[model samples]
Target chain A: MSIFVDENTKVIVQGLTGGQGKFHGLRNRDYGTKIVGGVTPGKGGTDVDGIPVFNTVKEAVEATGATASFVSVPPKFAADAIMEAAAGGIKFIVCITEGIPAHDEAIVFNRLVEEFPGVRLLGPNCPGIISPGKCNIGITSGDIALAGGPVGIVSRSGTLTYQALHELSQQGIGQTTCVGIGGDPVPGTNFIDCLAAFEADPETKAVMMIGEIGGSEEERAAEWIKHNMTKPVVSYVAGVTAPPGRKMGHAGAIISGSKGTAQAKMDALREAGVHVCLNPTEAGQKMVEIVKAL
Target chain B: MDLFEYQGKQYFSRFGIAVSPGDVADTVEEAVAVAERVGYPVVVKAQVKVGGRGKAGGVKLADNIDEVRLHAGNILGLDIKGHVVHRLWIERSSDIAKEYYASFTLDRPNKMHLGMLSAQGGVEIEVVAEENPDAIAFLSIDPVRGLDLGTARRWVADAELDEVAREQTAELLVKLYDCYTTGDCDLAEINPLILTPDNKVHALDAKVTLDENASFRHPEWEEFRATETEDPREKMAKEKGLNYIGLDGTVGIIANGAGLAMSTLDVVNQVGGSAANFLDIGGGANADVMASALEVINSDPKVKVIFVNIFGGITRVDEVAKGVLEALKRVTISSPIVLRLDGTNAVEGRAILAPHLNEKLITEPTMLDAARRAVAFANA
Candidate 1:
């Protein structure tokens, strides 16, 4: 019942010959995702962990009828690879490359809208999306995640989710989908975008939103939740008083001018009826408290 | 990533944008020679990355070679917005009848191509655009088709560019887009795109920021980049392959986790004090990185106190504590350091750090208490 991907979803690995793609693909296959095919430019007809590989995404899709693609190309080639997959009619794309150029991402983002409206690109530098209890198409360590419950975890920080999940698992609670979303200066999915998807998913009864400094995405998402969310949401804004000039978490995770700080986001979330957790360790407990109250 | 006006103009010239003939001059003699070559009544512009040069007396009009020398001498050594003026651009002066501004940048997160156009150009268009956002129009260009001439013409016309000025501005738009994409530029701005009294259009000033990620394709830019003056702290951080940014604060922060580093900052402010900088040794924070971080922090005189917060996961607390001790040995700590080490062998780590504990080195039980005590000590 999770959003994005799950057990029955068929997946393709776009750079399957690469180290990361192969590693995550094996894990994805073990997590019950149907590994239909893979694309690795000149590595067609090859088999990676028994999954068939093709030269292009179009060929891979045609041969295996694959719907989703997990792209693991380098940052420099990420946009072009994603665009190629999009052109091939891949519906869901999870790009796991980090440090792509801002202008190149701009072009890819623009192309996503104009050329591939049917495709949903998850990340250029993100910790790919997962639809727990369904399929795992991301880089998240599956052993840490338990396939039960309806809580959605959306965060800009990857390690915080790991910590939060550790705490949640201790409480016998699990997530429907825990998305890292990545902390690049630019991301394909913002907190607001993830929030909308979570809101629409009936399986997700509660949400643990972890945000950091650097941008108004969290503030805007909090505002959106204040007026829209029906589910109990617990928020944690990480970086309230960050060092003046350091970009620590995600590239886009910066506190500048009047937007995107932990305090500002906390205030916004509080106004929206969200129980903002002050400590990362208390996030699961706080969400549990809110769920009990509900 | 920020480029000075002269560098930007050279990049713009590669795109065929009509700009007044100009040359960069570092000395008064060079300025006079450039002005004479351009046939005087030249404009002497300070070559600095920041805006507001016009109001800072960084821009001046010289009617003769003597006046060029006078303006160049005053500007070449001046400082504008913390950037010391090392060079000036001498260009044939254009008679301005009107001013307009345009820029191409990537809108964060949404990751879309952003085009900002303002009829009220020059003198900090950001302020004017903010005060009256309606006056500046924005367009998100589609990446596949790029920016078309029709769209460019429509945008200029919407911004109130006269019929005669439309073609030149439209041509400039295509060129700007080409420069933005091909140059791998994060930002390309032209302020005061002058509408000459003769109806000719010219780009009077240019600012371009290249995307550092795409620098691999531009080997020539490597030299230009090295020549550009950067914050010493940032330069040191970059040289060490560390991601560090200097902030105006008294408490120096060192954290293992990015989220924790940020939370450490929040906790500091919540308790009462400011953070000096955001230094995340990342998951790879070891004795070497820590020692280097200490040196970088020490370089900044603003850092009066230090805070080390580590919630060790994959990273061992004992390892981080060892790194701290190692760093302390190599670097003299005139300011007090408050450490809050938790998770993964924290007790053992604290025991290891016990020997190093003194007036300069302090340990707190939790992040909150550590931040509070650090701020207290910093102010003291």
Candidate 2:
């Protein structure tokens, strides 16, 4: 079984009439995800690609019994979409919109914690999650992933996640689940959250984590891995050659006042007994080695 | 999107917060005129984004017109922390009976708006937090609930500010919170929230960072963008809507995502080659986008070899390959190109490129092999 999503995870699409929503909704459905319905305000009684549409998330959830949602709205309306999903009792929400203001994200995050305690929010600028053969949600290409493998992958990047998944699948290493937590300054799910889930999954023999320069999340994850993780984990931190104080494409990938650097993160992971790879291919190879030893 | 102190003060004033009367000047004559208008005992402050302006002699009190001329002339071209000062903010100096600190920024870990209020101000808050942790009062404000007058009052009292300064400081804090939220700022800081002998409270200095994402809502931000200084390559890339950062190296690197683009840079370094820039095409690998990206990279004269690494997920490798060929036809690039195509129709993509393969255009099978070939070509 995969973590977070699987065949039983019924999904609803937010902003289904929009360009990205329609395109990825069809892709997710094609990948075997149970996209039961969609939500578009004032477009109830409509259908997008054979899926029912409703005026609100609550109505969509009521009609289709959808447990999860994919938020593909514009940045201005993304916070309200997340709130509507939470208010409609969606257990998991994956947001794929980028360029959302940090203050708006702050409000959504605080409301999720105070109002909806058990719900999980994945990303505001990420490529969602894919559990391989079972189901694919969000934007990650499903063909590159293998199902029910011994490895679990979590990353902060979209294309980098694809690179790692492709490398592992080429090496005949399948995955239980691959999660992209996104590259925003504030993400709902972090490395530690995914690592904990991977550690608990009995089918997952090893975990591969992909991080970039920014924040102290990697260092904190290293602390968590040292104390609690029982499975072997390999990791890669991007931006080793990046200049300090310049943001490297990602909003969260800035080195501020010597606080977040690639060397510091790599050193922290090494101290926790984690094998840190220098590049993406090496990261995939390191995961293969750890899984073989297991 | 970091605002200069003068710009931050302008924003604070819009929210009804008290700030010392100031006007920006670009030359010594303009500085003298601003000083004369603002009255004597003006502060000639160099306007730079970096800190330590006072210690770097970019800040000086001018009691007379000649002093204003002298100070403004020196501070205008002064180098503070590697930032050459090109502007000065001339303001009537305030009488400080006490200095306090207050700021609002996002607390990433807690996912809330964090407000820091301290009676110990005028110095770096980091030092206060490190040396006397209890001197500063930290409060996490729910972005939904927001900061009210009662909460601001209690926060001011908890910071142990003088009783005479409490009421006005609380009111100013509420206004500052309004400026922070309604202003769409990532950070709104008053390093020296001062109280004068007359028990008046006002902001002595402002440090603000506006949220660039919120530019859609605030069209007035065009003024801020007009004053920004950026690298030529970065500016061109921004105009082309490509995610790019200029660096001082030889190998120009391009990829599909931020993470992979960064990893490409690292792998180039690991293979004994340095990257000239970091460019992320971001899921759009069509002809126009690829041509624009190539044009931006080719504009940099230091680049000897261009590495185009594409790992197509939602993006198809065939579309990327076609885009690369189409872009090659549009621009005359001096650097040799090393291409790596993988995932989702990679075979078809490679076949599409096989006919175009020559001494200048080369494709590798793997990321490592592609990086090695690119580095070797760059050195050669």
Candidate 3:
């Protein structure tokens, strides 16, 4: 009962001939994702070690009947690739390209909402999703994730997502799906979207969310959970000591005028009956405790 | 990136939005020159990005050449919140019949552009929101359809601006929306969108934040790049293409991603230590990237120990281990290094680092263990 993708989900790579695209695409394929096709505009008809490459997403989707897309194009062209996927009727998209202009993301995100209401885009700078042994997408290492467990994970940061997965795997707990919504100012998917999905899934008994400073998304998620969530949720918000106005690496990870502080986010989550941890290590332990009681 | 007042005005003007006539001056003499050209009864405003500049005496109205020289001399070389005023924006002062607030920013939750307008201006919007929430009228505009004049007119009327000021404010708001969207701005604000006695509406102040991600399309933004006063360590890291932010601490930290790097800082503080900087190698932790990061950290004299934390996802642990070794070979460090490598191919990565373990180089089993060791080294 995994969400988004399972063993049967057919996936295609947008820039499958490029270095990151080819490497991670084959990794996803080798991890048992039914990678049906690949797309490279000029390199259409060519193949990457047998995965068919087409010039457009429309051709790949039609020929392979692929429902999901992994956009690995560079930042400048990433928005176009995502729109192309939407145009071709791909339902779920995971964009792993980082450094995309925020304005492009805003336009593309709204376009998806107005024009392609059915399309779900994950990230422009995310680690992708993995439903344990069932399916793996994006760049998340398939080794650290265990299959078919009670926990569902979501995060904004890539390595923290890996760190959380590693922590959970070490605790001998598996997950239903681990979604990285990316750490961009304007991501296609957010914590709320993933949270709602996790809540609706019967297999996910508990949820663990990893958030950081910048934006009101985490605060909004807290409000939503207070009203809607039934299962126990444990969370971690990074950048506790981050100074104001300083961007801590990721583009969206900045503390702005009195809002988007780690303290504010943590307080909101705690108020929502979430077991907010002080650190990632503590978050894993808290999740383990919740799962044990469950 | 936050634009200086003068730069924001220039950006606003590009989108056909009306703003106070202004010019940036680097020196007091230059300020006087700009004020003379812009005309008397001019305002000399500090170009620092920080707020409270007006309270800090960084803003002054001068009616004549003597007052201009006096105000410019005082404002120049003044420190407002640690930002030394290296420049000033001299503008011709405008008569304010009424003050209003207007801005366009992304509403993250709704995934649309949010426009906030209030008849109550020159004060923080939060104060307006808390004091009289109804005083501010909110408009959500889809980036696709954008804002129209009719919508802007209704929005201004809803915001309860003076009847005389509504039409001009509406027109300017539409232009401001253009500046926000087409100008590639994360935030385009005109705090105190002044309505003059003549019923002319113009931005008295500008608070614009350019989306740095949009730099690829707008090569003209290269001009803003020259205005930054960056920390030397951060400047060095930026050149090497590593995600780095300089901090004041003893433990030098390097991690694989932004979140982990920040978490590393938290863990270090929890273990009774502080991080000197935040450095994210960001998936491509090759020899060159690692060596540059190491060099940047080593340049910080406060750093006593280095902590390299990598949890491989697409980044292979073995590749990271080799990169650390290669980086060590390239940059001679005065401080000990604590390494914690995990995730994909971790066993191979551990084996690769085994031969290099010594007094100067150490490996811990977990993130907490590595943080403790690094903190201990710093205290030692």
Pairs that collide in candidate 2 are none
Superposed model 3: Cα runs more than 4 Å off: A292-294
* Candidate 1 Cα outliers beyond 4 Å, as residue runs: A8-12, A16-39, A43-67, A87-90, A114-118, A130-147, A166-173, A213-216, A242-249, A254-267, A277-285, A292-294, B107-111, B130-134, B256-260, B310-380
TM-score of 1: 0.86
User: Model 2, B28-128: lDDT tens per residue?
Assistant: 99999999999989999999988889999999999999999899988988888779999999999999999999999887767788999999999999899
Please write out the lDDT profile of model 2 over residues A1-294, one tens digit for every residue: 788988899999998888999999999999999999999999999999799999999999999999999999999999999999999989999999999988888888888989998999999899999998887878999999988688999999899999989889988899999999999988988899899999998888898999999888999999999999988888999998888887787878888767789999999999999999999998988887877777
In model 1, how large is the Cα lDDT of residue B232?
Answer: 88
lDDT of 3 by residue, B1-380 (tens): 88988889998898888988879898888988999899989999998988899999999999999999999999999999999999999999998889999999988777789999999999988889999999999999888889999999999989989999999889898899988988888899999899999989899999999888788888999998888888989888888888888899999999989999999999999889999998888888888888998899999999999999999877888998899899888899999999999898889999999998999999998999999999999998
Model 2 residue B282 lDDT?
A: 87
iRMSD per prediction, in order: 3.2, 1.1, 1.2
Please tell me how candidate 3 rates in CAPRI terms: medium
After superposition, the stretches of candidate 2 with alpha carbons farther than 4 Å from their true spots are: B77-82
lDDT for each residue of candidate 1 in B1-380, tens digit (9 for 90 to 100):
67778888888988898889989888899999899999878999988877678899999999987788779989987988788999888999888898988899766645667898878887577687679888787888765568989999899888877778889888888999999988988779898788998898888988887877788778868757866787788899879877776778898988865676777777788777998887778766688998888888888899998898876654678999999988877888778889988665678999999987998899998677888899999888
Relative to the unseen true structure, what is the C-alpha lDDT of residue B241 in candidate 2, on a scale of 0 to 100? 94
C-alpha DockQ for predicted model 3: 0.79
Give the alpha carbon lDDT tens digit for every residue of A258-284 in model 3: 889999999999999999998888899
